[model samples]
Each structure stands twice: as C-alpha cells, then as structure tokens.
Target: MLATIKNISVTYDGVGKSFSSGDFISGRITLELGKDCKIDYLSIKAKGKSEVRWTERHNNTTVIYHSKDKMFSIEQFIIREQKGQDCNVVAPGTHVYPFTIQIPQQAMPSSFKGAWGKILYTLEAKLSRSMRISSKARAEFPFVSKADLGSIPELMIPQHGTKVKKMKFFTSGKVGMDIHIERMGYYLGEDLNVVVSIENSSSREINKYTLYQKDSFFARGKRRVSTKDILKELGEPIPPSGKLKVTKVLKIHQHIVPSIFTCSNIKCEYRLKIVLDVPYARDPEIKLPLVILPATQTSGLQPPPYLTLGLTRRERKPTRMEQHTTISTAPGAYPPTAPGAYPPTAPGAYPPTAPGAYPPTAPGAFAPPPAYGMYPSLSDFGGKSEWEKR
Candidate 1:
C-alpha cells in the first residue's frame, strides 16, 4: 500500500544567535500509511554548520574555519553543518527522543571578538516503515552575527564615560586614538557616514583612551533598535592632539531597512554617538559630544515623526502657556513652540509656514514667541490635512 505524510514542523532552541547551555532545539513530524498497513520507526535529529576565513594585513598569518565540530558526547559530534542531512521519518513512531545538545559558553560567537562568518542548523528525519522508506522531512534556519568593525591593536585614549576630565594640577591635557571603517556600511544595509576627532591641549605625554555612546531613541525611551545593534571598531592609536589631526571615514549598518531615525525633546537635541575607546591614564581627559545627523532627503520631504503624532499620542491644541513658555517646570515640563503654530516675525523660518496655512489663530495677534524652549516636540504637531499633504 502506498503511504503519505506532510506538515513537518521545526523549531530553534535559542532565541538569540548566541546561546548557553540548557537550551533545546526540538520539533515534531506526522505520517500516514494505507489504513492498517502496520507502521513502525521514526527518527528526529538536529545539526549545525559553519565555515570561516580571515587574513591579516601586510601579508601576515591567516586563520580559517577555527571550529568544525565538537565532541558533545561519546559518539555524537553535534552534526555541525550538514548540507545533505535528512530525516528518516516513518509511521507508528517510537521513542520521543528528548534531544538536548551541549552549547558551551565559549561556543557563543561575538562581534569583533574574533569569530566571523555565518552559522546555520537543520533537522534530519529518518524513517523505516515495515522494512521500507517513503521520504524524508526536515527544516533549516540561519544564525547570522556580524564581526567587529575595527581591530584591537590601535586602541588608545579615553576608553569609557561621557565626561572630558582633566587633572587640576595640569595646565593642559594631551591624548589620542584612531578609528577606521573596513566598509562605510554594509553592502545592501542601512549605514551612517561617521567622522571622529580628538585633540590634546595638555603637555603631558598622556596615552590611553575610552569610548561611550547612547543612541537618541533609547535615551528618550522610544521604539528603535538598541545601540548594540551594530558592530564597531575601537582600535588604532592616536598621537597628541596638537601633534596629529586624526580623521576616520566609516559606515554603520542598522541591519534593517530605512535605518536613519531621529529622537528629540523640549531641551537640546541629542544625536547618535560614535563613541571612542579611551584607555585610562594620569592627568589629561578629553571629552567629546557626539552628534547624530541625518542624510539629505528629497527636497520638501520630512520624516513622519517630524510632522505627525505617534499611536501613543492624543490630538490636542497648544495651551496659551505653552506658546509663551510660561508654564512651571515643577508641575509639568510644558513645551515652547506648539506644533503647526509658528511665531510671528520669528526672523527666519520659511515665512512661518505662510500664516493661516495651519490652524487659525485666536481673533488677533499671534501671541509673542513662547518663553520656554524655542522648540517643540515632534509629538506637538498633528492634523488630518498635515498627513494628507504627504
């Protein structure tokens, strides 16, 4: 009798590309045979595969596929990377096969931490029905993790923290570091053009560096990719700031489409930080404020956040106090300029969006510029017409 089977399910044990012990990759399979043809064995298994290669600069030593397979047990090699592995699934299955593989902490691949290339896994099902085989069922998935953005040999200067500290006894400060980009951004990935510079004003021959960064969206508690989303390079040394002017051109990939984003509030606007790695030293401490700037878009086009309200925001009009910036910060941090509401004779803003082009004003005067911060949050602006104009 001819037999048939379909709908095989596959699952991954770990949520992240990197995993520790105790995680299990499991799934199930179904089968059907000509009524009571007496079915038998069904087998399920998991496998992993990886291949890598790296070459040093100036024609130095090289490394290739550092890891191939590991002795997880007496006879199991974790079936690392099987391109032709299959599942011999069958009817009347036996043995649930509580498969649990070992994934040592060191097995975890990292960014710029030495390991590079892709790691993927698949399932192989073998079946024997009444001393015969029908077909095989299986599933495959990818484990992708990017490599480090820069080398470790060039790391020097301030390594971490946000403040630029200088010893009180020292009249001036001096230190430096270098940063380079192997690729401006990813080939088919969203990337940001970045440039960094550090200067030394002190006379001491200081040499150590640190780097730190806080992406704007995260600080504002908004929805965006985490700062750790991209790979970075913090190596290369820097000379005294006065002695050498260091400049690096590189790209950062968001690994997502439309990578460019923005976050703002009532106070000073914060940008994406291309933080530096400054090692600790005595005396001079150089502090730098990283700024995030978006690329030029088609003229007259603006991000939705810049002109509309998010799902969490409710529609509302500007309070008289908000326009004048007279509200108390103690009670509530009221904003300055209201969205779609411009200040009259504000001296230089495209003629105030052509007065009356927005919501109508109250009877007379445009209520002098609000006294708070001379800016408004992207959430401040909202209207059906505004969205329609797009």
Candidate 2:
C-alpha cells in the first residue's frame, strides 16, 4: 500500500459545449529506482475497457453489450540489458505517458435521458523482476445530440422561389444562411431576434402565411425543435407574419443546457425554414428549423428533436391594483426620525383643517401650570418670615 506511484491526468483544451471525443491527451509518468536495480525487464502501459446493459420493456428482454469498452495500452519502453546500473538505474526512475483517444460517433448516444454510458482509461507500470506502483485517470462521458450538426442560411432564399404549400412557404433562404454575427443569441437565457424578409418576388399579394421554425441541428436527423414546441415554452400567443419578431426573454429557473458537446475542429450550425404557409394569406402560423453542425460536419451532424412549449398570447390584466389605506397611527403623528419620515409628535396634534384656518389649538395644548409663585416670593420671606408665624 505504501508504494510510490506515477502522476497521471486527463484534460481538454476546449470548454463545455466544445468537448470532443477526438481530442488528444499527452503526459508523462516517472518511476525512481533505489540502490540495487532490477533483475528483469519493465515498462508502462495504458488500458481501456467498458460494459453497457439495457432491458427493453416491449419484450422484457435484456440487451447486454460487454465489449463496448475500448483500451489504448502501449509499452512505454523495455529495458532488457544495461551496464550493472545502480538501483536507481536497474529499478531506475522512468516516465510512462499517454496519448489521445478519439471517440466514435456511433458510440455517442442521443441527448435524451436514460441513454448514457460511462468510460474509463487507465495507465500502469509493470516490472517483471519486481513489484512496481501504478496510477490511473478516469473521466465520465455522455452521448450528446448525435444528428443535424451542420448547415446554414444559403438554403433559405431559393434562387427561383420558395416552396408554397398548404399555408406554408419553405426555403433555407439565399443570404440568411451564414450570418456570423455573435449577437444572434440562441442558447438558454439568450434573447434571439431574427428577421427573414420575403419580398413577394412573384408580384403576387400573398394573403395568408404560416411559419414553422426548426432547430438547425434537426436537419442531420437527430432531435428537432418545433415552433409549436417553442410556443409551448413561451406560454403565450405568438405573431405569425407581416413583420413578426420572436423575442425570447430568458427566465433562469433550472438546468438550462449550460453547454454543448463538440470535437476539437468542430463548429456547430443551426438552420431555419420560413414557411409562408398560405400562398396569399398575409399572416399564418409558420415553422423554422434550428440546426447545429460541426465546421467539419458538412455532411452534417444530426439535429435534436422537434419541440415546442405551446405558448399562447393573451391580453395582460386590465390595469394596476387600486390601492387605498386607513392609517392606524394618526397622520404625521410620529415625526420622521430618519430621511423620509416625519418627526415624532403627540397624537392628533395636527388636525385636518381647511387651507387658511388657524390651528384648532391642539387638544390640551394650553394646560395652565399649577399656581405657586403668587402665594409667597422666596426672597420676600427668606430670612425670618417663619418667626412671626410661630
């Protein structure tokens, strides 16, 4: 139990949403040998292993996956012969480092709950002639959205025209495809303001229109978010068209997906399809798709699910509350001791009176003092006034 161990660690250069399975890790492990060295060979190695299991309810059958574990073990170096080296040389100190391990896309589970697995990577030092110490670094992995990880607006404005259907106009849009303005927000707590302009290029007075917004990521076949789903999140009625701007003000109450998962050289993308539902109807409920893809995922990352919170619009309560109060303490009774408060005064000192009326003489305001001085002045009978009375 009291053996010297090598230092080992695993880290990524990218942050939260950008963590990838293909990122590489590089580090070293050192071992120190004492006085007299080893009698056999020695080296360092890395091993990976994992197991997954699940039971389907449809048939009550358990599906077992035992070989899901992948390892990356390598013999750091073998020392077979050397001049009769000191213990430090024979059992000598050496380093056993590690390299990067790429995560397979198929292995990445969707972002849904109950679809997850754990992975472990370890490194150890082995010596044939003697017992040596070992060390390992472990990390937890979650399967993020596995689809619709790419694309943009170039698909919006079709060169010729937008597809018109049952109250819907669809297109990736010509210029709206790749607007790289950081100010366009989409994550939790972010307010997204977007404008997709369609100029009846057809010289027709489009009477009705409907729009549906989709999560860009959904394009790749992952999960997709529906405008209806977003509306549900809003809990209110939303405008359909003409000039409609969806301002999503964030209400941070719980786990609002704080980050995204990605690879080292990956850039995620979102897509939008403005469905001018009814050909001529001016305003109609429409749909747009938001997509997320890696810069390299041109083939595209799968998108999330189509979702909406079903939010509706309604008139706000008529007006502010009508406030009225009855004071328990007399008006201005206690004069403010601090700023904004009146100074303390006896109850009813200041009675309600018409504008120019004189003070009603606060009740008991003129209480006459007890009569005393008129009876006899102290100076008048100071010396011997008592003698005469005796």
lDDT of 2 by residue, 190-291 (tens): 333433333332222222222122211211112222222222232122223323223233232123221222211111222222333333444333333222
Candidate 1 local lDDT, 1-390, one digit each (tens)? 343433333344433443322233433333333323222333344444433333334556452323232212111111111122232222332222222222221222211111232234555554434456535666563322222223212211122322344534534453443333322212223343333445545443433333233222211222222233334344244444464434433353333222111112101122233443333444333333222222222122111111111011111222222112111111111121343232333422122254332111323212222222211222322221111122
lDDT of the candidates, in the order given: 0.29, 0.27
Regions of candidate 1 where Cα sits further than 4 Å from its true position: 4-22, 37-40, 51-118, 144-251, 256-390
**Model 2 Cα displacement at 196 (Å)?**
9.5
The TM-score of predicted model 1 comes to 0.28
Q: Candidate 2 lDDT (Cα, whole model)?
A: 0.27
